[model samples]
Target chain A: MPTKINIRIVTGVILLTVQVLMVIYARFDEARYFCWAPHDSQNEYAIFATVNDQTLTPDQIQKRYRIKQKGIDPRAIQHIKDIIERYETTYGKDSPAEVIMHYSTNGIEKPSWRWPKT
Target chain B: MSVNPLKIVNNEMEPQLLLTAKAVVLGLICGKYFFKLSDHFLPVWPIFDYLGPPHVFEAVLKVLFIFGCAGILFNCRVRLCCIILGLVFLITPLSSMVSYRNAKVFTGFLLFMIGLHKKGEVPWLVQAQVIILYLGAGINKLFEPDWQTGQYFEHWMHNIIKNPYYINATMLLPPMMLSKIMCWLTIAVEFIFPITLWRRFHVSFFLWTGVLFHGMALILSGDDFGVFSIAVLCSYFSFVKWPELIRVSFNGDNLLHRIAKGIVNVFGFDNHFVWQEQAGGPLVATINSQTHTGTLAFKKMVLYLPIFYLAVAVLISLAPTAALKSKCALLLYVLIFPLPEVIGYLKRKREKA
Candidate 1:
């Protein structure tokens, strides 16, 4: 085996080489941004509302309902449906167009929305 | 202070546990869940866009990844096993996205580097990786005004903050100013993570801080991140300096050093070897009269234990008819935790040779 120092130099060179490759890949090709930063969802997507057809203001919905544009699964759609139903039962017949879930795709600002699946 | 990462030698037994923990993660996640053809994916590389892991090949690659992780868990031809997985990732198109997370990529590189670092000492590259990750995260947080104001973590415990007086065992702070304080404290610690690499800093304090941070993350974060907190905590194993089981020097004995010596004596192997717990535990030390009074824990004569355990695990995995691959997993610790006697035997053999 090489001396630990020599081994470390080799490891350093390898790390440097891979980092170079990563930079090139990110710069030219489509690589995931290696920022190592956590996403701030709240500030980026500032819209928060409940919708039956027309968007309801924050007070009508009981729970905290923030409109996001991704992670559109069945459960979220159901949550939207439940919220809309709750609003109508208590406040008596708001716009019944539909409840929807919206979030950013890839947890970044690319807007998308999905209607609730009944 | 610029400290030499190469001089930071780890005990011979430390990497074994780290590798084992990584293997446990692989066995649980890749072996259990990631094998599904529909879900399994190799992150998108433009060159390989058209060539995804084909129908049957996908299954083969997943199997290889599982076995490769098993091979590493046991320390069998780890370099080769890691290369095999690397090849699988290269050849297969099982990734759901065009790219994987930076953490995944960093760990892949780490797996390769450690596989090559067969001598049991943690590589300087690994040290650099850990330090850089913390620094990068800290610097990123520093740029965010909200983090400076300690906004995110404060609201992270929203339920308790809303209630006038509420307390749960899990919720340590009642969503008060303490949340902001803890948030800033965490960021400060992370920013100074590089200081741990310096010779002046006490490694144990930072390591314990890391343990506490991850422990809190595990308890408080709920299930959002899955096993990520545990995984990061396990990576801390690479940084620990194991307790020296054989002593080579005549430095003035401190009380704890004396106690460490007593503990080694109680465990036997006292006749031919001296012991000290400088920081890490169960490191092999080679002693010779002509050489410096005692050799430090850089000896790699006994690293094959994990390989042997891996073989045992492989044998067990194959035999159990309704095999849950993890059945043989816990036995890895059983094989590694004991045996200064075995290390002594290896030392004697090296001397004879």
Candidate 2:
């Protein structure tokens, strides 16, 4: 018969083996779980808004309205565009969010900040 | 002679040690209720949107999650209740978010795992997971050009923060100098955090440094990071040796003993429960009363640490400095935790002398 310590040891082994296996499986089965090997600080999206040279206060530009997109998704442009328009209409159309932000830690990499021509 | 950490054992205090860990999780979860209620950070996720469980049912799931976690904390079919809690988390919209997934999903899994090990000490797996989190964070930070150079950190502090006292403090030096120092320190501490596993004292030291870093950072700069900091700090509760925990419960003069006595009174049990030891014999707690004269097998699980921890969480919850005070409480234990080892070493020296 297994003693209490033995039972605990077995349980720990089983759980650990299964979790490690899950991480391995995540490599192949993307849907089962997300990436196991975390992306080191690769893609960063900094939140910034400005009028020419003067940066806008974080209060004026709602931090909640800030968009953090993952990877090379083109839809990121649209999201940022929406936030800018929302900020303009609500706060001031004349004081549009001018600066392009480039801060991201959502485990996505290699994205550029490009301004959409108005 | 070097101490072997694995040789340390006190099977009798296993449950309460784990229960204390549960109390931290429960407290953090309860603290999170306000944020969730106000719908502060719930972003619409594309994954949960299409995979369904729709955003509308969040309130119902929150209620279910609270009760489920409460049931688990109370130790009623803990594993089953934890699974119910996990399912709620898995289906929640925010669960798909990277931050939420990293925090809640991993933590829920840990709770379920620890529940399974209730009869034993906190499992080796939970300890490894914490090591992995720090190592992962450190490794992740290492490659970041901004973390290496401190440029991003400076920009973040100077631009992102609104009205934090620490911002002024950081200005005592060149903006880049402080950021650069902090950036590197974070990486170094996290990378080496896993080494604490080799010894008990090392674990406390490592955890204390982490608490100080997080606690001081939060207190000086109100950076909406209290949740993550407290959740991680609670992980250290698992590493607390069972013998020390039992000693705290038995020593009638200490706060833990008084708390234990208070708990006994609440259950209508005699508050005179005392731990008695004899030469070359097992330790035992004697329960002597008018009608009942009994010796508890010192069997740990049939005992508990929930009430003690809940009482602490409640005290912190009521305090105006909940964040800072609770952080101090955790930080205070860092010094307190090493007393047993310090005392033991001195006793051995005295005998040798």
Best by TM-score: 2
Could you report the DockQ of all the candidates, in the order they appear? Answer: 0.13, 0.12
Residues B123-156, candidate 1: write the lDDT tens digits. 5555665666566566555655556665655544
Q: Report the Cα lDDT for residue A27, model 2.
A: 44
Instruction: Report fnat in order of the candidates.
Output: 0.21, 0.07
Q: i-RMS, every candidate?
A: 10.4, 7.8
Candidate 1 residue lDDT tens string, A15-110: 645554543443343222343443321222223344544665545433232223223221112233333344434333444334443443222344
Model 1: which docking level applies? incorrect
Clashes of each: 22, 7
Quote the TM-score that chain A achieves in each candidate. Answer: 0.29, 0.36
Per-residue accuracy of model 2 over A7-117 as CA lDDT, tens digit each? 655665675566566555544432223222322222335556676567666664445353443232111233344445544554345655565655443233335454333
Question: Candidate 2: misplaced stretches above 4 Å?
Answer: A1-118, B1-21, B34-60, B90-95, B98-102, B116-118, B156-175, B198-201, B223-226, B244-353
lDDT for residue B108 in candidate 2, whole number 0-100: 54
Q: For residues B1-353, write the lDDT of model 2, one tens digit per residue.
A: 11221111223225433454455445556567424421212233434434434344556666767767665555455545555665565354253332233445455555545545544545565676666566546655675567798764565556543335447767788657887887898788877776665345566567657767665555444432433444566666666553332321244444544454455545422122444333333333432211111123222312333344455554443344545554556544453344444565697799999
Alpha carbon lDDT at B267, candidate 2: 42
